[model samples]
Target: MSAQESCLSLIKYFLFVFNLFFFVLGSLIFCFGIWILIDKTSFVSFVGLSFLPLQIWSKVLAVSGILTMGLALLGCVGALKELRCLLSLYFGMLLLLFATQITLGILISTQRVRVERSVQDIVKKTIQNYHADPEDTVAEESWDYVQFQLRCCGWHSPQDWFQVLILRGNESEAHRVPCSCYNSSSANDSAVFDKMIFPQLSRLSPLARPGPSTDLCVVSAKSHIYREGCAQSLQKWLHNNLISIVGVCLGISLFELGFMTLSIFLCRNLDYVYDRLARYR
Candidate 1:
């Protein structure tokens, strides 16, 4: 065997190893994606709450990992079979997937931003009304009614109230309504009042119940703040992760295209060498 034969053998072995590595990696990533889609609640409870600003990072990472594994598997198959058609199909699928993700990410980000703005406005109006006439009997009464409903629903303290309040209006004044103010026996009046104003106040509850460290007894702007912050945080978190995943997918697709081109060049060179050697013989 000549030096050229040795080089060809080495190239073949390398492609075989690459194919196996990518096949396993792709399988694992596909499994992980299935897990994410299946146990979404578990993912939200464990990873979502822990990584506040980066909550969506895990999902994006999972997506990118899966896409990369897929591309690698395709490239390996194409190389092993010496099939140009397979290589072309692989590149096409990779590009299509990246484009689809980019489009979806843009749409979701836009919708989320709109929702955050609308929620913020409702919070602002409620706060403005509360503070504009803190001393007025009607205003105080309305504020008390809102606070009572929040507590009944589950808010426990001024701080909890505050979180909800700030979520509505970041700059709104903090009004503390004592628990004594709520009359459970007067269910009719409470129900009517809650129907009128508490809807906005209630909108600000966090997705997760704050731990024991959170003050459950207080009702203040903090509740509003937590609620608003969560909305804003969620949007930011999603955008960041989506951008990363899309970027990675684009990069991997380009890499696969490059590899396919290189493989074609190698095949052509091998064919030319074989033809020339046969003619000389």
Candidate 2:
């Protein structure tokens, strides 16, 4: 065989090896995605439902992964066959994958903003409900201080850390807090101040120092009731949830990147082979 022919043969062998690897990777990703969609035992299924009202976000992510994996498998097959039509389809699939990620990213960012705003609103309403009169000067001062400190702590929305506080309360009360007293001072008055207030406030801002702790007390009269340990538990729970979501997004990005790179390499190899064959003819 001529030098050119030898090179072409080598290229074909390399392409075959790369294609095999790509097929395996694509298949694994596609199957795993399907499993995530249907398998109740999957981590995505469990963690997703744990968020209850926030499960919508997790469902979006799972659907995105399924679509990406399906496209990736099709691309791998098209690259191996060197069919121009399949190649075009593969590119379209890649575009879809890119678009899905962009959409999910935007949604997540917007939801984060919404959550922050809702938090602030809850705090203001809670304080209002606690005062003898919603327009009381003491209540107004307390609400302003709480809102200001929350904004200072990097919460940019009209609402702030109040969502987390409310969630903590709901969990503790087991949803038993009466609707009338749920966001009001009557609930605070009826329950022991220490039991009802301190636990929620401590969970909201465990990182606060002495002055901030005093501020927390002003904002929530029952602030001192919780044991110091509850703060760490709440912090750890939040950290773990955030980490899991980040990890899922990163993994999907990496898988799409690898599939596209491999597809390009295979197409170039096929082109090189076709050119060499024409020369020999």
Candidate 3:
């Protein structure tokens, strides 16, 4: 076999395998999105649709994963069939996806600070409704989960809760936070105390209400509420994670570029290989 034929054969096999891996990765991400969306035991499930970017996560993951898998399958079929038209279509779709990824990356990078601030604003709004309604158990559970997972309290600082009605009664003293800040396990134990707060806030925030917390347990001796603000913790977490996130995007972009290059070479050589075989015949 000519070198061109050998190279074409190699490229075909390589694309098939690489795209298979891509499809699998896409599947994992898609399944994860579905799991988080429907998960009853997890804090993520309680995050309301009004939660700014949080609510978008599952849908975004599912949609993007499906698109990636589709692209991978197209590339695999194009390569295996050695059909120039299919290959061209595959290239176009990959190009479109690459452009989208680049555009999103640029937007997120340019708007980093604004994005963080926007998320905090949403959290502040959430805090305003924290205990505002006796029936808002989901919102309460969601905030508690945020503090537990992010290991931070309040929107700006632990003291920010002071602005909430929970701290603004005639007592006007004693620095306390939603029990979740100290420890999540004690959340139910602190609910009876929190239920009392909702009635006080009812007149203030114009939000709906929630279910009652049962199975009261005794509070254990814990040191303190989380000293850091969730906003800052969230900012730091985003900063740290941004590295891996960028790395993955960069890696996928490079893969797409490589695949496109391989595809072009494979297409160009097809005719040459066929011509060589005709001469041998």
> Each candidate's TM vs. the true structure?
0.39, 0.38, 0.67
Name the candidate that leads on TM-score: 3
**Residue by residue across 1-281, what tens digits does model 1's lDDT show?**
67765665465456557656876776676666666555545544554221121224346656777766777776677656656566566656756765776687677677977866776565445434543442332332343444343333222223333334423434545554333233435443444334423332332235544322211132333223222223344445557798797788778667555555555544544665577579889
User: In model 1, which runs have C-alpha deviations exceeding 4 angstroms?
Assistant: 48-70, 88-258, 270-281
The TM-score that candidate 1 achieves is 0.39
**Candidate 3 colliding pairs:** 134-210, 135-209, 135-210, 136-209, 136-210, 137-210
How many angstroms is residue 250 displaced in model 1 relative to the true structure, after the best TM-score fit? 11
Kindly indicate the candidate among 2 and 3 with the higher TM-score: 3
**Clash count (model 3, backbone only):** 6
Better of 1 and 2 by lDDT: 1
Candidate 2 stretches greater than 4 Å from native? 1-69, 106-111, 118-248
**Residues 1-281 of candidate 2: C-alpha lDDT, one tens digit per residue:** 66755654454355446545655665566555555445423442344221121223335555655554555456545655566566566666766776799787888677977865676566546443533342333433444333332222112322222343432354454211111112234334534334434443342343534331122222232332122222233345567788887888888677666655555655555666688779889
- For all predictions, the C-alpha RMSD in Å is 14.2, 14.1, 7.5
Provide the lowest-lDDT 10-residue window in model 1.
Answer: 48-57
lDDT at 20, model 2: 59
Alpha carbon lDDT of each predicted model: 0.49, 0.46, 0.68
